[model samples]
Target chain A: MAGGFAESGADLELVGISKRFPGFTAIEELDLTIPAGSFFALLGPSGCGKTTTLRLIAGLEEPTTGRIYLGGKDVTDTKTYRRPVNTVFQSYALFPHMSVIDNVAFGLRRRGIREARALAHEALKLVELDHVAARRPAQLSGGQQQRVALARAVVNRPALLLLDEPLGALDLKLRRQMQIELKVIQGDVGLTFLHVTHDQEEAMTMADTVAVMNKGRIEQMGAPEELYELPKTVFVANFLGQSNLFTGPVVSSGKDSIVVDIGGRKLEVPRERAQRHAGEVTIGVRPEKLQLHGAEPKAAAGTNVLGPGRVTDVSFSGVSTQYQIAIPGLGTVSLFAQNRDVGAVLREGAEVWVSWDVAHGFGVADDPADGPRFDPDDDTRSIAVQRREKLEAELEGA
Target chain B: MAFGAFGGSPATTPASDAAPRRGGLIALFLLLPGAAYLSLFFLVPLVSLILTSFQAVDPNAFEIGKFVYAFQWQNYVDVVTTYWPHILRSFGYAALATVLALLFSYPLAYVIGVKLRRFPLLQALALTLVIAPFFISFLLRTLAWKQIFSDEGVVVTALQALSLLGPADHLTGTPFSVIFGLTYNFIPFMTLPIYTSLERLDLRYVEAGGDLYASPASTFLRVTLPLSLPGVVSGTLLTFIPASGDYINASRDFLGSTDTAMIGNVIEANFLQLQNYPAAAALSIVLMAVILVLVGAYVRRSGTEDLL
Candidate 1:
């Protein structure tokens, strides 16, 4: 599977890359390849090693035990300047002293590109920021500066372009706008875009392929729909979106689907989608995939599974109404139903039936190697505490 | 009306009415000690110096160190005309010394702040060493340097041995020696401000520059130097202003000769040996005015709108 680099002309290839700081392992033997002219995103939670992978590819940091190839040539030992790669930094690291035009023209100027100013203007025009080309970075808003950074990197036309959370500093509205803009821009100039972000929604929105990382390792990599609909790990399921998870033992297997006894209730999931054998497994479906009813619906045949639950919480969002259902002998699970003009508006303390197609359910092989059993919405051990522990250890050694 | 429209909001009216009086009173209270101290120490000396600059001594009155005060403003003209060369030389030497100090300090500060940042212990050690000279007296340091470049000293001897200098040529009692001493003595002042600015610099810009394919040297010139201008301005000011009026380094009895005498040395000679207080006072006033003008022009030219 990894040998595709030879046939398809991989724009970037990282073979067994690992980066270790003094007391922390950033990435552990990561292997990834991106085909030319594709927008790929590395998505993860903080400290999950997505950024380290990008940095290693950009030649900002050297990997400890791997070779990095750009356009099928090993550039593992190349200096950042020598590497034909550019990065849009998270802070938009624009030279504060230079005008926006100069900032955009910086890469070309370094390469001794004649008519740097005219070309820089062309790049700014690409981002629709040529009007503000003469202004310094501080004079522009965060969104404007972000575009300039994009223009700067894109003007280089490097073999690989890495964006380290380029839209992270913008507000929600601007971020959404920029996300679409980025997708359009990527389409316009199809360099091998490698964007790193901790935001799952952003990755789903922009990248053609998304890699979900957890604790210095990639949990799953595929198209966003594939990862979301058929996540191979509980981490991917929880991280990509909210997934109502169930841990149970497999009762029977079929050519098409597998039936698992989830604490008593038998649920059928597509057999190929199940990453486990006929044994213990953890399975989940996204909140929106399950339907909620006032009473038990007639058990439909042909891959439809049914379960009885009671509505514990009712949250009516503008477009969708969400219900927290407490299944008997099973934990509470969330399900979102679209708000309709003619439907029974479910309320708290109402008896409800949660039903989903068997094909919607996905299963993982119930491994104990999960990185932090996380509540998707709840706080985990914060990075500050971990950093403090590292510092204290460092001090003690000192 | 525009000011009133913006300013006279009902929410802020009461605060403004009460605050101004309270603020003025508080401001007065805050100003009392500093203002009184300046009036006593600074204003008094300045008033006496200005008065002395306008005074004249009777050439016939042979009472030792006697001066009957008169509005003899020609003392300013006389001092400027007689000591113009010394004044120009002082400024020239100061400019050279300041430039030299900046050149030496930029690399030192860069290494300490950026290069050694990962090694906090080493960085602190290097910074401490940079500031260690302040522990020693300036006079002692200058005198030590004077010894190092004395007529038959090791520096001159080495230069002679290398044939870079003739046997009769010397490092002491020259413009070069005085300027060198000034640069050496003021290096810490130049270094610390630059270290502060460079320490506060975002390393990501350098990384971004590199990622853009700019070499390290070009990055330093384009990104690092421009951002560190505030520090350079402050460092140069700190070196130049003091060096311009420095007496110890250019004292004929110490490291300099008559030919190498600066404005400060001339002022010293007129005040103590010649006992021409008016000329010295006039020259002192001229030096202060020139420095003020030059520093203002410099600060303005640097366009440090953000820094100041």
Candidate 2:
């Protein structure tokens, strides 16, 4: 939590931003404040408008509503080149004809930078690309070219550095290496970094603050650990990690929690009033938290109880084994056990006791108030799209 | 030598199956028609002229010693010594015309290609204007130039009115008229190739250059022009070759300035007026040889055979 708060010098705020393209809205009523020198990430799936948010912040696109404040100045209508922000595009977009030194010095050249060679040398040294400064982009590897792009943007010394999936083209090993490099660079420069990525892993690894976007809006925004530990919606939970959901009706509601009867088994979870309903509630549990024993506990357990079940299947991974257990009156539940010792092995068809702590389950007592009200007409949309594609193919053939 | 870890040694094919089977038949089928046409129209006439070069003309104005086989390779030496200045003049005029054509068309083609890319009809119209001169007869166009640069023409009238010249006698039959006609007739050759190349130039390079902080002009000089060198080479070759050999404009349009007579005029005069078949054939051979050398150098420089 040392760098969790905003820094003092590089404050950026997006105030009540809204952007619409004809009839479609790309981003709506978005607001964010990033402290100076903080690494911030916008995380979302494709078409979630995360890239659009980064573009708007870079002044590449204008917001239909609201203002952008850099430090304290409003720059909502400023053109991209006029703003004090530079972007490293996803494709790296390095000029193919120019040498690495020239590419790095290009922004300075525009500003009529005196001693451009020395400044370019310094920027290349920072990116550890000084030795190859005379080489063209086609001669450099993908990782080296990306570093050149970074050096090119940073040499301008813009107030904010924007990254639009700068590592999206790298392979897994290279991407991991670049993630570390980018983090180190951000720390060394002490510049505000606004990065856009769809990778939850990248966001968790690098960002000081993470904002998860969905359907043109921020679904949740917080530190990675906070979002991971307490997701507020099924979309966030499913996107962040794996979860198994159980559907049932609410049996009782308490001051801070609710008990739901899932297939005759009572499970207690945190009471979120927005989702509180008496019937048709769902409970989510992580598979790793469930435990399995050969049989039920010798005595009646405490609030954390054991359920009788038969192990239907066992899967052996390199470091862990998963057991799928079927409990009577309840559906099959999955249990994950790490290889703690030599003898912690479960076989298929073994009768076992599956147990979980009551507090571990996350409850969402279904409220019709919150959205995605399970419509019956979603199938028609896919059917229409398929039909259109078929018609287009036939027209081309004709 | 050490292919142990990566893979086995490369495979070898049997020598028995190496040669192309039934190859000469296919080759002949593809080439015989063209070969027959060249022999009938080109090869036989060339051989007859070479045979005629050794003969002495009789008093009856008929060529004798058709079969005496008195080989006169000195005919080539005499013709070379007599026509060397005309050869140099042709090259000078062609070089000047090519330079003038490039100057006039490069900006026009660049604008049509890069600036008006979104308006395709405008590009086509611009291209049509460059090619419009070719639609008229070469004789007619040369005649038009003759009138335009003549003493009684409008240009002479205008210059006289402006007092830029003393009188109408100063204007006609100058070398300026010949070069102008040459440039006007062949300017389209310079435009189309350069236009096509500039049109196909990748816009991504420009955007990338701009993003790197390069002004538009620097991008053009550093990225666009160097990459369009192939087009320049092809356009120069296309305009220079035909203009060097052109005689219709020189013979019909301008006064017989020794410096203005192109090599094509030499070939045409020997063929039609002097009735010197041997001289005409030898001169035609020399022109073809020069063209082949220039075209070969151009092709080698461009690293492509399709430079034209």
Using lDDT as the measure, the top candidate is 1
True contacts kept of each: 0.92, 0.21
Candidate 1 lDDT score at position A122:
88
The C-alpha interface RMSD of every prediction is: 4.8, 6.3
Q: On residues B69-166, what C-alpha lDDT tens digit does candidate 2 reach at each position?
A: 45667767777899998888788888898999999888988998898898989988888887787789767877777777777778888889999878
lDDT of 2 by residue, A134-206 (tens): 9988899999989999998887777788898999888879999999999998888788899999888888899
Give residue B127's lDDT in candidate 1 (0 to 100): 98
Give the interface-residue alpha carbon RMSD of model 2.
6.3
Q: Rate the local accuracy (lDDT) of all candidates.
A: 0.85, 0.75
Give candidate 2 regions above 4 Å deviation: A1-10, A15-29, A58-67, A246-251, A261-264, A272-283, A292-336, A341-344, A347-398, B1-202, B223-308
Best by TM-score: 1
Candidate 1 lDDT over A1-398, as tens digits, reads 11111222247888999999999999998999898989999988888898888888877888889999888789999889888888999999999988899899888888887888887898899889999999989999999999999999888777778999998899879999999998898787777889999888889989999999889998889999898888898788877877888878889988888888887788888888889867788888888998777776887764445457778876655577667888788888888788886553977888778788877888875543454555432112133345557989999989
- For each candidate, the DockQ is 0.45, 0.14
